[model samples]
Target: MRLARQRAHALIAKSPADAVRSVFDLMENLPEVERLRPSEVGLVLVRGRVGGEGERFNLGELPVARAALRIPEGPVGVGYVAGRNRDHAELAALADAMVQADVWRDRLEEGVLAPLAAGLAERKADTGRKAAATKVDFFTMVRTRGEK
Candidate 1:
């Protein structure tokens, strides 16, 4: 279920709030969920390293949205997604709680996670191809002094 939660969080961050609605809409049996902490948007400090191993520093502040929900029939779930879309956060937390429930785990992964993963991979590959097109290489050729 931990893997599902991670996938749900990533999908929520990568995809738009509207994307999640279609998945739930397709389901004939939707589980009841309570919003323990209705989705809220706020700012958080994003930390980073200058060169992957340099001193850590506050990169910048980024707007984030988060939600907390509980399945009265199961466990409470929390979701922290990038961007300030309240609906995305809410849906992510709902997915998190649903994944915790055994019956819904596989269905949610297939209906939601799999498609999102595919789209994300596609986007990444496209970006990589574009970057590779402009890639540059440099080499140094040492020349020893010779009499001519």
Candidate 2:
């Protein structure tokens, strides 16, 4: 089985509140908005695959926040994110709508997604560095009598 994957909007949806809010704050002419589905928190069943692509199993339930909203004059957007941050979810949905609009798409990409993506990349690099710092490598060598 295959799963559909998306990056940009997912990044936005999962971004920290402060990060998302900074982008939201930059918008000059946000259209009037309405909630198609109010932001809400719930639990979603997490599934895992054994050995990555082997048998699948239920991992557990995880908290998720989701929101669906629309610009009254334009596109609809949806957001789903891990954790229980309703505000983050709403902001993500708003960004999604903005990204879909021709007017806001470029601005959203430049002012919002670009910086968010850069920050995310930096964060990943920092995490990798931290993990590398703690990484331990082990090896065993057979003693040859001749060499000894």
- The candidate scoring highest on lDDT is 1
Q: Write candidate 2's Cα lDDT for 15-101 as tens digits.
A: 688998887788687777899977999999999998799889999999999999998657887888889989888878877777777
Q: After aligning candidate 2 to the native by TM-score, how far in Å is the CA of 35 from where it should be?
A: 1.3
Q: Write the per-residue lDDT of candidate 1 for residues 109-139, one digit (tens) a residue.
A: 8878787778778989999999999999999
Report how far residue 146 has shifted in candidate 2, in Å: 6.2
> Candidate 1: RMSD over Cα atoms?
2.4
- The C-alpha TM-scores of every prediction are 0.83, 0.85
Question: lDDT for every model?
Answer: 0.81, 0.80
Q: Mind sharing the TM-score for model 1?
A: 0.83
Candidate 1 runs further than 4 Å off = 140-144
Worst 10 residues of 1 by lDDT: 16-25
